[model samples]
Target: MLDLTSMKINDNNDNNDNGWLELALSSNKDNVKNLIEIKDRLILAYKNYENIITEYTTNPIKSTFLQERELLKSFYEKAPKNLNRNLLEQRNEHLFEQCPFCGRPCKPSILDHFLPKDLWPEFCIFPNNLVSQCDKCSTKKWSHYYSDIDNSVKFIHPKFFNLLQYIGIQIEINFPSPESIKQPDFIITFTLPRGININDKKRLSLHIKYLDIKTHIREYITENYLYWLRVSEQKRYYVPDSLNQRIKESYTGGNNNRWDVALYLAMINNDFIINHFDSIEIKKEIQDHSDIKLEILTEE
Candidate 1:
């Protein structure tokens, strides 16, 4: 996950300057002037929204312009591409190679509404309300912001918490019995930094659970193990050193919480894997019964 600390609604270009509000207002000719009255209020609400959502007990924040909800949501839904083009570009300028939501080494391709547009449509076009995320994560995290049971905010706001920098994830690989080396099972867990607040800790845990982050990491490792193993063998580099180089390269730029980086770090720390690198044989069964010397094409 990435910390989009620099991205916020107020910091972005005013939507009014781009005539987005005007374009959206054009359709509702009857209520145009009425809706225009709340334009500044909406902007102010978007700016101060994050501050009010400080704790689990805090009530869900909605537009104070309750009577204008339909007009605002309708305008947002029917907004033309040109209006969004600039805003989306501005948001993407700071996007990292990794998705902000999952940190899966893919640049974010879609803008996810932090609060579902169905429920809180006033902020539908708000820059702070839009989270840049990969398609898979966006699909998985679709419209999920708060817990249904407790009605608490679930996903940590990237712009506010900067939680990715505060929390670290660890990988634990568990090999099968000595008789079976077919596949190694693994677990992904979080390592919280000292002095993190209780609310943030809960938010982190809820984010991971809500997004199914651990399961996804585990599946990725299991599915891609042979591919990485084959690549390492072909390159003829020391496995530990290769892993170290990878971790160093990708784990730079203040993002040390990536799952792939965590995997490499875990392998580097495991004495069994490190010491047995040279002798670690690619068993035939594990290699789909193909000879190790033959070219093996594995999906990334």
Candidate 2:
């Protein structure tokens, strides 16, 4: 995922330059001091967001904050729309290039409220809380949470958190026999960087699991494998260095931000995939990795 540097700042000649934040606060202001109150609370919520993330601590359930959050929620309930189409388009096309979450290739179809609207409608239109994602990803993220107690689960935030730097996927291929290269076995696993604690690790694992990342990757692999199989008989796929080259190209295109980018890089780097370019390699077995366990991902 890309960093949050691309999010726009205001052109309003204001020194503070909180463009999106200022617009959100003023529009929601409703000409009442309550709007000012909500803005103040929003500032605090932003503070808490920063503290919780930077300090790596649990969220404190404060009553005052909760009441303000309710007010914010009520405001959203009667708002004109969830997001401004002009803003979404401007940001998606000019600012945010792609859905950083699933690494979908283009501007997303839906504007996802990263924190579910039902749970935290106060964050409904919050810039940092709003992530541009495809319909599929937006649907999958509905009400998804690793922990019910707190919002401390530092899962992949397409807005600020970049999973590309911290997590790397590894593909392992296990053959049933040494005789043939067709229809063997494979497993995909993830590796976390050093110094990451157990709680963070578990949270990251939960993120990948619930998103059905393995399933998505497995599906792509199978489709690609089938395509290669059909072509190999005619020597199209059997041509030396083609698979690796394609993978490299995809990785280069994505700059390692997309999951498929990592996946392709993994495939190219994998010795077994290089050795046997025509195998369908269904992931029917678990591999031996201390940090990551293989799951049986199905086509269905």
Candidate 3:
């Protein structure tokens, strides 16, 4: 199972141009309209911030610009809370990571409609629908939402999803693969659906399409499959004691649990041990042993 050691708060890089809040405040509409206005404002402010960062690299900034930076920072410090504090904080932190889709290493200044907000305004503010992305990937996948929303909801949220519920990680001794050695790779067949009925399926599909979970899976495979395979071969003859100890040390060092998953998958797929270990059985065992549970509401 994937272990979440601790969640760390990222550095505050909030730029204080409260144009979005201003838009929300100025909106004459009711609650939903106000929410939409606020959403738009957030998007615009992010875009503006992105532009500022972009220009910083190429255009020399005047002393006045540096002064404005301090002003913006102060404004953000005192900005009123509008949404859930935890969620807002997480969103701000996510902005620091590169876009998962395109590998662009910058926080996007605009909200991407994984499923266009137009189609499912209900999820416009859902944290799962919001991911920090660069401009190029945002434009490329602009209208490309998921085809299966129901399936999408079943998928894990990178920020909030529990990896242990539907899937588990472990290093199997034997599996069939091109690499002669055993290693780990993530494996799972079950999908999630808390209770989405037929109608809900249609709606869920919208969310799924928006997030591009399928694309994520493919990307995961392409990126880690071979790397894990190589690891398996190198460590094949190594005793489990040493391997487990190494893993324990790495865990203590705060390596991501996804690394373990990669090792599990590689071990399973390698041809050296297919008959010895049942991949599915081992997977279920891992899930059962894990502490994480997937549920609709956030854990309190």
Give the best candidate by TM-score: 1
Q: What is the C-alpha lDDT of each candidate?
A: 0.67, 0.54, 0.39
Winning candidate number (lDDT): 1
Ranking by TM-score: 1, 2, 3
Clashes per candidate, residues 3 or more apart or on different chains: 0, 0, 37
Better of 1 and 3 by lDDT: 1
Give the local distance difference test score of model 2. 0.54
Q: Of the pair 1 and 2, which is ahead by TM-score?
A: 1
My TM-score estimates for the predictions, one after another, are: 0.75, 0.61, 0.34
TM-score of model 2 vs. true structure:
0.61
- What would the per-residue lDDT of candidate 1 be over residues 267-292, giving only the tens digit for each residue? 77766665456554444236545645
- Best-to-worst order by lDDT is 1, 2, 3
TM-score of the candidate numbered 3?
Answer: 0.34
Residues 1-300, candidate 2, lDDT per residue (tens digit)? 455434522232222444344655556445435656577666666545544444434543433544555556654444433235434553456454445665444566666666566655555545556666666667677876445554455356644555534555665556677764556465877776688888777666766666766776666565665565455544523433665576666655335545544545555665665655534221211221344857998996
- Give the alpha carbon lDDT tens digit for every residue of 221-258 in model 3: 44554554344344433333344564565545332334
Give the residue spans of candidate 1 off by over 4 A.
Answer: 11-48, 61-78, 90-93, 179-182, 233-238, 253-255, 271-277, 280-300
